[model samples]
Target chain A: MDEIRIFAPATVANLSCGFDVLGCCLDTVGDEMLIKKNDLGEVRITKLTGQDLPLETDQNVAGVAAKSLLGELGSKQGFDIEIYKKIKAGSGIGSSAASSAGVVFAINKLVGEPFSPEQLIPFAMEGERLASGNAHADNVAPALLGGFSLVKSYDPLEVISLPSPAELRMVVLHPLIEIKTKDSRSIIKQNVSLKKAISQWGNLGAFVSALYTEDYALLGRSLQDEVVEPIRSILIPYFDDLKQVAMDKGALGFGISGSGPSVFALCKGNDIAQNVKTAINEFYKAKAIDFELHLSEINTEGIKILE
Target chain B: MDEIRIFAPATVANLSCGFDVLGCCLDTVGDEMLIKKNDLGEVRITKLTGQDLPLETDQNVAGVAAKSLLGELGSKQGFDIEIYKKIKAGSGIGSSAASSAGVVFAINKLVGEPFSPEQLIPFAMEGERLASGNAHADNVAPALLGGFSLVKSYDPLEVISLPSPAELRMVVLHPLIEIKTKDSRSIIKQNVSLKKAISQWGNLGAFVSALYTEDYALLGRSLQDEVVEPIRSILIPYFDDLKQVAMDKGALGFGISGSGPSVFALCKGNDIAQNVKTAINEFYKAKAIDFELHLSEINTEGIKILE
Candidate 1:
């Protein structure tokens, strides 16, 4: 039985009003899943490292994603799955998605890559559903396909690639606290005002336009969120303080990452990005919150096989 | 006093959910306003002709726009304003905007074109505000600049030019009826569901991405309206039937123009454009509703001086 090792990048989804549609990959944070085929005809959860995780292979997100792929292949060969935890679980940095994406990507290659990325997204989303009870592709997409991605539809999933500017940089801060995706999604009101919705749509239009045209100024202006951020912001401690600090130091815009506890700031040049990282660090120091900051370029290359 | 003739093209504002953010110019339907500076301190409305217009220039939309521009310039020199209305009023073709836009475009030219197209939009919008209580720049910006324009901000108006696809074609049909912008806006709900707003944002994002990448398929799919069109569509005659016919005839998509009575369909090819036009004309014919159809490429040249 041959052995395979795969790496999947972490992602920030929801991107403020872009809820299920917009997402981008981050290079620094992700997970590594290693798989080896065996003749036992039984999937085994061999080892779990980094943060404490589920031991049962069936209950494991990465294992489930791998199992789904293997089931599709109808292979009699069993496999041993091992996950090296890199992105912290429940940090809103796509911790679970890394596992799912890494496993799926590795297994697809093992099975001769029968499923396209689009075809694999739903299976990956099922992994997300196992973790959050909601099938969301925002995290899974960027994890699978590097750079900026748009999930046009999720029912029968469709993924579209968006233009990524070379100079784009991201400053993300994860405050040590847990905010479940399901709970965060529940706190938001089911309905919104039409006037506000229009404003959000306008901003989103500008955001997409900026991305395509590579207009930095317009991108900064368009990164505003009048719809979801205002509601979900209350869940994060010192969100306002951290955001203000980041913006004051040259961040273009800052918003909750996925369903928060983690926050990301879009920055212009490296100078601004470094400044934003420092500002966030200072705020966390003052607040006495356990937080980590990462200065990352847009991950144009999503998942890759390390070995 | 120099006598000059200027023509401002008709415009479509609120292109989908862009409400106040997106606007575009149309080549054919327009209004021509002639301005002559006079020694008198009082501005006088001189003549009005074409397309069933008000004889009284002071009460006319063109006069109001011209007056606003004069006020902005602090032009103490009184002017004689003559309007040749080519576009019909209340056709959802931005008739008043053409007059208002023409007044500003001509006044700027008459006074040496001091203000840029960006500067003229606000002055034109002031004129638009007089007719419709809402101060929206969708119509005026397109009339002044031509092609597709995005309004980033309104308080201190900021407008940006968006890329226009070469093969893009617009088919506009004016259904003979009166639907005021205010009335059309009023019919929509004050608020929307957050879930629905997310859907709208997703579509808007896809639409904007499509515009930048020139992806016609994404553009067609993204042209959906979950909030505004469903409610306001009732006001237009045979709105559903027209849309069905137009889409079946090869329109990429169709939607109510501005505040309706007029409907516009987007198509990629000229054959589809003609087919859409014929389909719309047939629908109106069956309903015994008098209508006019215009098949135009996106007008890159906005307001111009007519020799």
Candidate 2:
């Protein structure tokens, strides 16, 4: 039996103004998978460790993506799979993305890396599809390639990695709650007012411009979300207050991370990061909600194997 | 009278996926202004050098911006203004923006450069305000800065720049018909479907990312307008066919330059530019509409003195 092991990084999706367009990787948290080829011609889950997760590996997002990829190959080999989930699932830290990305990456290496990064996006999106039943690449791209990435097109080869600022330090805060990506997605309106769209695009344009120019102030200004944030924010406790506190603490911007419960704040320096983290923690404490805070630098190098 | 000359470059607003977020400057054609400080204590138009234009200088778009800036300063010194409209008025290639930017630039110089570029954006917005009755800076920023620019916040302070690909060549075609910016803006739906918005944002995200990576193919894939283009495109003759012609001729992408009556195509090389120009010219000849073709580079030097 040939065995392969791979890792994929966590990501923050719905990045402020980017919504479905932007995402970035995070270090120190992700999912690891080990796969070995067998002659059973059936996929089987051998073990699961770290973080309470589902045992039905076929239904598991990362395992599903791996199984789907293997199924598509029409290979007459069964696979033994083990998942070491490090990132807290549904924490809005791209927990599922790390799993999906890791599984696909491990499977690809095990079978000889046949597809390009672009080619793998759809396969990764399949994992996303299993998770949300809707295909999106904002999370998957960053999980695949570390650094700032964009989901330009989603079908017939999704696009990734537009211009990103070199100075990116994102501080994420996860409030105590489990918010499904589907539930968060559902809360959003089916239609958006054109006036709001214009404002949203205006900010998105500024965000993109700031990335190219390294104008941190402009990035701060453009980090506004008038469309999705306002609607979905209702799901998070003390959402508005948290944002105000983070901003008052000198955060460049604040937005709901991925499908919510977890919120991310963008800052300029380590001092700002520390300040934002402290402020966000204080906000949660004031609200009497138990939560966790992750104050790390932007994980420009996404997923990698651990020695 | 102290005569001073100022020039403003043409601009392409709503660059594909950017919609209201992104725009860039075109080097080929623009508007020019000659301002003469006088003791008359009021702005007066001494000459109109372009094609038939509003003779009442006060009502003119450029004149409005210039007058507003002067009014804000409360200067008793009068100014005699001469307008040289090189970029065709009412063409989608940011005709209103050139006037607004040129007048603002000329007035700034005439006033001994009283305000910084940041301060001048609002003044220029005044000109756009006169033209469209709404103050927006998507066109004005690029007209002022030349390369790809963003107005994260339409407020004067939040304007910034994004990266521009070095190999960008713009092929613009005007079919001689005038399309008012106001009318084009009105035709767009005041509401957008959420499904469409996701697709739009996805493309916009890709477009912004493409700028950083200089991925031409991704740029092409992302160059889609589902909301504004579909509704407003009906106004342009052979709009779809022209886009096909330009794309078939090697244009990376094609869309309405600003509003309508004029269209622009983006291509990678000079050879593609030449091919697009010939293709567009043929479209015009086939339709029996007299038209003009422009092969231009992305103008990185926005507003300048043309002697």
DockQ of every model listed?
Answer: 0.60, 0.62
User: What tens-digit string does per-residue lDDT give for candidate 1 at A110-140?
Assistant: 7678888767877787789889988788999
**In model 1, which regions exceed 4 Å deviation?**
A41-44, A71-77, B51-58
Candidate 1 chain B worst ten-residue window by lDDT: B51-60
Question: Please, what are the lDDT tens digits per residue for candidate 2 over residues A182-290?
Answer: 8888888889997777677677756665666677877788888888998888889988988898899988888989888888888888898888888787767777678
True contacts kept of 1: 0.67
The number of the candidate with the highest TM-score is 1
lDDT of each: 0.80, 0.78
Model 2 lDDT per residue over B110-154, tens place: 778888776777878887888777787878889887788766665
Docking model 1 quality class: medium
List candidate 2 stretches off by more than 4 Å. Answer: A5-7, A50-52, A162-167
* Candidate 1: tens digits of C-alpha lDDT, residues B1-307: 2878877788877666565677788877777778888888756778878766665656767677777777877878677888877777888889888888887787778788789888888878876787778778888888888888877666456777777777778898888788878787777788888766777677767767777788887778877777778887898888888889988998888887788778889889889898888877877887777888888888888987888
DockQ of predicted model 2: 0.62
